[model samples]
Structures are given as C-alpha cells and as structure tokens.
Target: MIDLLKEKQAVLDVQPAQSGASFAPVLPVDIEARAVSKRFGDTPIFSDVSFRLARGEATALVGANGTGKSTLLRCLMGLIPTSGGSVHLLGQQANTATGRELRNMRAQVGLVSQKHNLVPRLSVLSNVVHGLLGRRPGMRHWSQALAPQSSRDAAMQALERVGLADFANRRADRLSGGQSQRVAIARAIVSAPKVLFADEPCASLDPSAGEDVMELFFQLVRDEAVTVVFTSHNIEHALKYGDRVLGLAQGRIQLDATAASLSAAELRGLYD
Candidate 1:
C-alpha cells in the first residue's frame, strides 16, 4: 500500500539527510589563501587576508557589504589576480597556473553565483548540459549547440534530482526565482565537482523561497559529499544551515567555529 502520510511528511521536511557513506581516508585538500590582497589600481579593496578550507566540509563566509567577500571568491576562482600573496586549490598553486591549468582546476570546482548564470535563450536541459562543456576540450560555439543524446539524458537526470524534471523543456529565463535557483544548482552538480562555491545563492529570494533553495543546497552537499563554501549576509540562515561558520570583517577571518559553538551574542560580535 502507498503511504500517503509519509509522502506528505517528506514534502514538508527541509532538513538534509546526514551522510552515511564512509569516505576513504585521503590527504586533506589544502585550499589556502596566504596573505591575499586585492586592489583596483590605487583603490585597495582587501589586504592581508588568509584562511584554509579543508576537504569534505561546509564553510560559511559571513560579513557586511563592502567587506570584500565577492572579491575574495573571485580571487579564489582565479578570475582576477591578487595583488599580494596567493591562493592554492587542492594543493595546486592558483597564482602561478597557466590558463589551461587553471581551466583544469576550475573543472573540479563548481560555482553558483547570486545572479543565476543560465543561458536565457536555451531550454532548461541545454543549460544543464553546459556543465559538461568543461569536459569537452574542443567543443564550442555552434558546434556544441546540439548536445548528444547521452548528455541530454544526463541533463534530464540532473533536473530530476533537483525536482525540476517537468520543466526540462521550458526556457530558463521564464522560470520563477526559486525554480531558476534550483536549475542553477542542477547545472553545478551535473559536472560532479569536488567543491561547490555559492555566493549568496538566496540573495534575491523571499524568506520561504530562500529557505527552500538553501534546503536543496544542503541536500546536494550531503548527498554528493561535496565540499561547500558560501558567502552570505544572512546571519540566521548561516547559523541554521552552516556546518562551520566563518566571520569576515575588513577582509580578514575574525571567527572560525562550528555553528553549534557560536552563540547569538558571539556571532553579533563577529559582525560588529
């Protein structure tokens, strides 16, 4: 017999399931930022910030506006060069890597920005297939427009995992904010990255929608056992969802502790 009550309960619950698979003991990935600094010509945005992100963990970076959070993410992603020091991803020196090497490194890392980066003109399935583009070295422009049947199947599965399978044929730009965010997440995970970086993923959503999106993120991290690092301005959300909370002020890490370890008062001090 079908259990209607259980199905209904599943729809209401937002908490992610705990990881049950035991990961093999491997050398921890050393994601380190050593004395990193950034500047736009003469205007310095951040200076002498350093931190390390260990493998197989979730870390939340929290701060006020203009605290260099986005700049730090860009630096980590190697989108922009830092003025001083360096960033190392999985033990590879990001500062010295060539374009090809950097692209290789980026393949292992996934990013979901505040602004959804989906191709508006494409169908939802096509946008998800973009995750596979990093794997195809020579495929680009019009040549890559027609995704293979296998890739299309994979994209459909990804959308199904995010509960958007029914909308696979819809245009990405036509979806609601929450649905768009889920599609963005589906695209990120389709590549099966080792680490996922989200920059204020729920910044534009309403309270309920934000919670729904965050719930999906947590589920992805736990189910896939992918390392997650995100930046957010929402303290309550950080406290509720983050495994490890990092408070950044003035472009430096001021507090690093488990979410359970930080009291409300302590969190306020970090923000202040």
Candidate 2:
C-alpha cells in the first residue's frame, strides 16, 4: 500500500509558506464566511450567517427540515452563488474569483453530498481517479486509459485509506449503499482537499451502517488532517461525531459551541 503520510508530504510541497513584507500572512482558518445570506427570488433561505472552519477540525451543522442546512453547505462550497455577503475558502474569495481561479480553488476543496454521485458503470478505482480530472491539465475525463501512474497511485492510496483497495476493480453499482458512500469519500480524498464538505453523508444508510461510515469518515479526516464541514439532520450523529456544532433554526444560528459542551437534551430544545 502507498504511504498516505508520504503522499500528504508530497501534496504539502506544492503549498509553500508565503513570505516577504508585501505579502500578508495567511489566516489559520480554512474557511471564512462573513455576513453570508442566500435567497431564491424574494424568499430568503438564510440571512446574516457567518462562521469559520479551523484547520483539521470538524464542524457539524444541525437543523430541522427547511432550515437551510444543505443550502448553506452548498453556498460554502461555492456550488451555488449566494445572494449577499462574502466567503473566503482556503484564502480565495469566492465572490470575485475568476473561472480558472475558482476551478483551481475547487480542486483543493472536496464535497460529498447525500447522493453518492458516482459513475455507476465505472470501477471503484476509476471513479476515484476521476477526482484528478480537474488536476490533470487538458486530459479527457473519460479516457482512463491515459491516466498517469501518479494519478493511479493517488487513487489507490485513497481507496486504501477508505478500506476499499481490495474492491478497486468492482463496478460502483455493485457495491452496497454503505460501500458506495465510502467510495464517494475515497473519490473526495483522492483530490487531497484541504477542506471536505459533506452534506448528510449518512442519510441513506441503515443505523449501524451509518454509524460505521461516520466513524470511518472522522478517522480519515483526523489522519489526513483535512478540515471537515458537514450538515446532518441526525442530532445524535451530529452530537457524537462533531467537534463543534452549529444549530440552525429559522434562518439563524441558534446555538454554536463545542459538541462536548452541548447535550442532546439542549439540542432537542432548539427543535421545539
């Protein structure tokens, strides 16, 4: 198996520390949102929201249905344009970034949503290799035949990290729901994103399977030192897995604190 730590070191080599008097020091925050809001026509989804994700930490967003948790996550990932405010992801301003800049910035950010979003017909390893498509200049996405050895190594390493290296050749559609989710995560990690955004990652799994997936996800993030921001409707899962929790209600953050400092009983009160 490829050494994940060594690969991580190689990845870090590309990210040299900035210096010189004219260059401003970079913020430690991996993600920063200030006075952010989202709306569809006249209907406001959320307003005046702000938060920061510290490096190598996991922040969970919890709320009832219609509370805009997913919408807010999408906004942070720059998948959708926000109605107001500003967002800086990995020090790149989302609002004014050019297409090429956004593309490059996006390569450093990974996302896993409720849907597995895998190409069912492809082998699990190939699906993970797709994560490098953007990173590979002028390469045809579907031409897996032309994938370089480095890309294959990274993909295999990602699968190894997710405990799916043995199933690299299996078709994505043949995997179980839980396995599919893991594969999606492997795809996300193959990109070696500094920040990983998961939207209700366990929503489709059975209780036991969901718990297992959550455990794997948290461990992977911790080992890889990737910052994570995820939204979950499962209060127990959020309280159990998150280092920090942000409770959203009626377009506002009703509560924000370390998960250890908050109890399930207190979180339930927000729902009522």
Candidate 3:
C-alpha cells in the first residue's frame, strides 16, 4: 500500500525561506496530556489518562467501542473541556489559554476525523483551502466560489500531497469514500500544522484503500515533523504504525508501552 502511494507522488509543501546559516534546533515535546479525564454528568468517559508525544512521534489509542478515544482526542485539542487534569500543546495550557492566544495555538493544530466534513457542493480545492480560514479571516468562507490565488495555489499543493490534484475541480461529493478521506487529510495538513489528531481515519474504507490512506496520512505528517495522536480499531495498524501504543479500557489506561514491545494480542485483549 505504501509503495503504491509513493508511486503516485505529487508536490507536498511550500514554505517561506529561513536564514541560510541557522542551525536546526531540536523541537520540544509537542503534546502533553497530564492525567486527563472526561465525563458526562455522572457517567465516566475515561479517567486519569496521561501521555505525551514528542515532535514527529505517533501514538495510537485503541479500545472497544464507546471507550472515549475520540473524546480524549477532543480534550487534548481543546475542542471539549476535560473533567479533570490538563492538556498542553506547544507549551501552552490548552484549557487556560485565552482569546487570541488560544486561537493562535489552535491554528497550528489540525484534525481529520472519520467524517470527511467537506461541503458536498464545493470543489475539492475550495474545501482544502478552508483550512486557511484560521490564518485568513473577514472573507465569507461559505459563499466565496474562488479563494485568493495564493490560497488556491496552496490548496492545490495540498491536494497534490494527497494524490488528488487532478480532482481539485471535482465536486467533493463526487469522490469515492477513500478519496473523500484523503481530501480531509489534505484539508487538515494544508495549514502546516504542528500537531494533528485523527480518529479512525480509515475506518470507512476497504482494506486496501484504508491501508493506503493510513500510509499517506502518516507520510505527510512525518515529512513535516507533525506530532500525531490517533485512535484506530485496527490494532495491527496501531502497532505497526505508531511509535507508542496506549490501551484504554474500563475508564483508564490499562496498558502503555512502546509499540515494538507489545503484541497485537496484548493490545486486543483490552477490548475484552
């Protein structure tokens, strides 16, 4: 699957020039979730979940259905309030950051979920360009048929990253399930995010397409040194693709270990 994706390579990114002589410094830890917990009134979602992902590292959350994997990702990304503890991204407390500070922090993060979350009637390029809405405002996002040339060019580059440049003019709803998911990925990464959150990114595709999407997702993030925290029902993909594997069950992290140290059977046992 990875080989196939590699064969269909397209342009990936465009970045501003930096100092020619500056040394590359090691990036700090990208995500820090300390004893994070979530609940709905009296019902517990998950409890005391603590973990960290260094820059460019990937961690996969695995458990049975209704185990709060998605909810935890939301908490880390500041989309929802955690019942207890805190999540820090890029050294700022996610729950405490306020106003423009919070917006700036979130602008550097991205999410790709099971749902493509694209506007059906919009062209694929327009949907991907929506990612820049964080960086550009005051323009009508929904009503604009054509974005600024720079935004369109960037969005096209993003589509190329996902092997969908040729489909840029196609209506989003016209694409297949796998293509839609890839478009979602392009939209998420178009902003050059420092961290990305994905929830079951390949759950809706067939085995082959699912693997290809996962590989593409991983490659794009790794190429730009984006930290990733994703949840997956496929234990094998989690173990094979993630540097660290975390098992959540019965409202807590039952197991946490390097992916290389844990077998698929051990991770699967958390579901039972």
TM-score of each: 0.85, 0.87, 0.87
Candidate 1 structure quality by residue, lDDT tens digits, 10-91: 4534556658777557648647889998898998887887777777788888877888888888888877888999999877
Tell me how candidate 1 scores on lDDT. Answer: 0.79
Measured by TM-score, how close is model 1 to the native structure? 0.85
Model number with the top lDDT = 3
Which residue segments of model 1 deviate by more than 4 Å?
Answer: 1-27, 137-145
Clashes of each: 0, 0, 0
Rank candidates, lDDT, best first. Answer: 3, 2, 1
lDDT of 3 by residue, 37-123 (tens): 899999999988887778988999988999998888888888888899999998899977888988899999999998889999988
Query: Where does the lowest 10-residue lDDT sum fall in candidate 1?
Result: 1-10
Ranking by TM-score: 3, 2, 1
Give the per-residue lDDT digits (tens) of candidate 2, residues 1-272.
11332243345336577677787545489888899999999998998988787888789898888989998888887888889998898998886677899899888988887799999988898888888876775564443556877788889899998899999989999999999999999988887889999999999999888898999999988988899999997888888889888878778776667787667776776676
User: Candidate 1: how many backbone clashes?
Assistant: 0
Q: After superposition, how far is residue 69 of candidate 3 from its true place, in Å?
A: 0.5
User: Please, what is the whole-model Cα lDDT of each candidate in the order they appear?
Assistant: 0.79, 0.83, 0.84
Off by over 4 Å in 3: 1-27, 140-145
